[model samples]
Target: MKIARREAWTGRVLLLVLMAATLMPFLSLLVTALHPSGSYPLGLEWPDDPQWGNFATAFTAARMTELLKSSVLIVLGVVPISLVVATMAGFAIGHLRIPGRRFVFLAFALGLTLPFEGIITPLYYLVRDMGVLNTRWAIILPLIGLFMPFSVFWMRAHFVNMPEELSESARIDGAGTWQLFWRVHVPLAAPATSSLAILLFLWTWNQFLLAIVLVDDPLQRTMSGALGAFQGQWGTDIPLLCAGSLLILTPTLTVFLIFQRRFVTALLQGSLKG
Candidate 1:
């Protein structure tokens, strides 16, 4: 009993330490951002009078208005569409167990191993050839494709882990494939789907490399992508830079905080159900 209690305290202390280490930089960034613009803000010192204008300056100077819009549009395009496709593919591979299911799943597994850096060059030329070049489609199309493998893998994990009785019961009740997916499985799959949507939303929103390489116009790129060029122009403005970064991060953070429970539920649901 003593040993177990000691271990629990040690673990809790270790976790707290880790959390502080992780959050320290972000706290420093927030402090730096709130420091009056012209003044040099350093260390973790809190400014006496916080520079709220830094946000406004950051918003306008960074062209956050347009960048935020582009990110929203891109995410809105990517998440739902990707979810639909991945869910369908996952259900087919996971639930249906169609012919060559192993091969199909293997192909997707291989795709997970294929990093963006490896194929980025070819992808550039491919997008150019498709005549999308600097357009928003340039960012949107590739993201959907790149997002597929992992999305499929995630949803498939959930579907495969689901109880056979659910599907069997539905089938006996005259549920066809589409009917099973739409009416029966989908409701039960909500936790997994919500989790997948959050992951997709994060990936799509923070998409940087492809957005930067594919779309030259900052206005057309993801907020994180636009930040690269925006940084070049305002690199010296530390407060503004920090402010813009936080703004870009806000939506994701908000979503995560709001739906963090669902995210946890997804994992638990997947694990316990399996």
Candidate 2:
């Protein structure tokens, strides 16, 4: 009993330390953001007078309203279409066992190994040659393609691991492929689909490299991509930068918080029976 209690206490202490370590940077940023906008503050020290208006100042100056709108449009464009394509492709590969699926899945596996930095240069020229540079489509189209591998991989994992009995039973009820997918499989896939949407949403919102490389206008780039330009203009202002950083971080965090339950449920859905 004493040993178990001691181990429990030790684990709690370790987790507490890890939590503090993780939160320390955000704490510092929050403190710095509250400090006077013009002054450079460092460390975790609190300001003598907190400038609460730094957020507002950052919002207006960085044109975050427009940035956020652009981000929403980009996310909408990328995530839904990506989800539909990924879900269909994943179903075909995982459930239908389409011919050449293994080969195609292998290709996506290769895609996972290729990072944005590795492909961004050629992609930039490709976009330029297509004459869509500085346009929203520059960000939108590439992101859909870029997000495909992981999204399809994620959905495929769920579908592949799903009980074949469920599909068989659905077919026993005279369900066609479309009916099985829409009425039976899809309902079962809700958790995974929502989780995929959340991931794609976060990825699309945080897309930086392609946005910076392909699109010229800040209003056309993801929030994270536009942060570079924002930094260039206001990098000297630590408080404003912190505030802007928080603003950029807000949507993704909010989304994760809201869907975190569904995300965890999706991840664990096929892992156990009860």
Candidate 3:
């Protein structure tokens, strides 16, 4: 018993140490962001005069309001489209006893390995032809396509893990395929759905490469793309840059924190089942 107690205590100590190490950079950034412009011997100390105004300055200078609106529009458009299309595809591939299902599943899974860079040139020409190169839809449309692969893969895994009896029982009660999926499977897959939503939101929110390649207009750019512009304009303003990064991070962090428990539980459950 004594040995076991000591081992547990050591485990707790190790966990705490790991958590601190992971959080150190964020804490340092927070401190630096708050630090006054000229408050130290070499400008490094606990802020003698915390400059909360840096956040405001960053927001205004970066035109964060418009950038934020663009991000919201992209997320709103992409998430639901990705979810609905992926969910349907997952349900079909996982539950339906269709011919060529395995081939379809393999093709969909391959999407996860496809890098955006490889397709960017073609995608650019396609979007350019559609006259969406500098529009918010340019980013939104490609994101939906790029994000669907993983979303379908994840939802398919969850659907495959669900007991066959659930669908069998529903079918016995005269429930059609679509009804079974919408009424029963979808509700049961809430945790996984929520988890995927959080992940896709983060991916779309922090998307820089696609945004930069697709969008040229500052007003149409997402927060990440706008941050690049901000960096270009105010590269020497460390506090402002930090503040802008923090702001850009706020929504994704908040969503993660809010659904953290559900995310962890779903991930662990999926892992165990798989």
Q: Please report the candidate that would top lDDT against the real structure.
A: 1
- Stretches of model 3 off by over 4 angstroms after superposition: 37-44
Q: What is the C-alpha RMSD of each candidate to the true structure, in Å?
A: 1.4, 1.7, 2.0
* Tens-digit per-residue lDDT, 1-274, candidate 2: 9999999999999999999998888888899999987787767889898888999999999999999889989888998999999998889899888899999999988889889999998999888898889999998888889889998888888788778898899899899998988887788888889999998888888898888888878888999999999999999998999999998998888989888998888777756622
- Name the lDDT of candidate 3: 0.85
Q: How high a TM-score does candidate 3 get?
A: 0.93
Task: After superposing candidate 1 on the true structure, give the runs of residues whose Cα lies further than 4 Å from its correct spot.
Answer: none
Stretches > 4 Å off in candidate 2 = 270-274
The candidate, 2 or 3, that scores higher on TM-score is: 2
Candidate 2: clashing pairs of residues: none
Worst lDDT 10-window in candidate 3 = 36-45
Whichever of 1 and 3 has more lDDT, that candidate is 1
lDDT tens digits by residue: candidate 1, 86-194: 9999998998889999999999999999899999999999999999999889999999999999999998998887778988998999988899999988887888889
Which digits, one per residue and each the tens of the lDDT, describe model 3 over residues 207-240? 8888888898867877887778888887776777
The whole-model C-alpha lDDT of candidate 2 against the native structure comes to: 0.89
| Predicted structure 1: lDDT | 0.90
Clashing pairs in 3: none
Best first by TM-score, ranked: 1, 2, 3
